[model samples]
Target: MEKIARQGLLYDFYGALLTEHQRHVYEDVVFYDLSLSEIAEEQGISRQGVHDLIKRCNKILESYEEKLHLVEKFEQTKKLAREIQSLTKAFSENRDMGLIHRIEEISGEIVELEAH
Candidate 1:
């Protein structure tokens, strides 16, 4: 994944765990696309301080993902759900038994994922 996109996903999955101060600074940098100097000026902190905080926030978010695997499971489940939707549509259009089987298989996979 691209760096920005990866960061966004990590933030989405783990951002709520951050302290309010960390969330404000990290959101300014990641979500608002503010430069470190800009965030520093606005927050009345040093530029280096903003940079370090952002880095620490990123590390913390990544550690949460590494331990919990929620982000990974979410992505996988999303992909499987899309596939199931596509299979359902195809089955509806063609009334194909093969499509039905595929949809069932995908549903089973989704169930298995949720169980974990």
Candidate 2:
């Protein structure tokens, strides 16, 4: 489930770079987690068409990620956020002053990434 969420985020990041048609079908099927039949009905296409468009869009998005690495950077940001959360939790429980400072720094870094 966690892996799915991570992949979904990466897909969304890469999806922003796709064409409108690709975005329409890909967003419906992937980001919304809709079934092929559901997407087909919504998009006025056959199930097979939706499936093929999704497959092609996936390839395009993957290619974009391979070259631009935005999705990779986004994943790294997610991992960093998790690590910062853990650090914050530990500092809260232990009242470690040094850990508090580190957490604050990391939190700032995560916020900066959010801007990008």
Candidate 3:
């Protein structure tokens, strides 16, 4: 993924663990698309401080992901869901037994993942 998209995904998964100030600053940069200078002006901090905060927040969030793997599991589940949807669509068009079997197997995997 691109830097911003990866940041956004990580934030979506792990941002609530951040302190209120860190969450606010992170939201401004990732969600609101504010520059460091704008964020610094709004927060009464230096531009370099804002930059350092974002850098640190990225590391913090990534470390959580490295330890927990929630983001990775989520991506895997989402990919499986999309694949199942496509397979179902193909089954509807072709009435293929192979597609149906694959969909059933993927459904079992999805169920097993949810159990964790």
> Please, what are the lDDT tens digits per residue for candidate 1 over residues 19-98?
99999998889899988888999999999999899899999999999899999999999999999888888888999999
What's the distance in Å from true for residue 102, model 3? 0.9
Deviation (Å) of 72 in candidate 1: 0.4
Q: Write the per-residue lDDT of candidate 2 for residues 1-116, one digit (tens) a residue.
A: 47556557657677667788878777777677899999889889999999888778767766776787876777678888888889888987998899878878888888888777
Q: Give me the candidate number with maximum lDDT.
A: 3
Cα error of candidate 1 at position 44, Å: 0.8
lDDT of each: 0.93, 0.78, 0.95
What TM-score does structure 1 among the candidates reach? Answer: 0.94
Reference-based lDDT, residue 65, model 2:
69
lDDT value for model 3: 0.95
The count of residue-pair clashes in candidate 2 stands at 0
Candidate 2 stretches greater than 4 Å from native: 1-7, 41-44, 98-116
Q: How close is candidate 3 to the true structure, as a TM-score?
A: 0.96
For candidate 3, write residues 1-116 as lDDT tens digits.
99999999999999999999999999999999998899999999999999999999999999999999999999999999999999989988999899989989999999999789
Top candidate by TM-score: 3
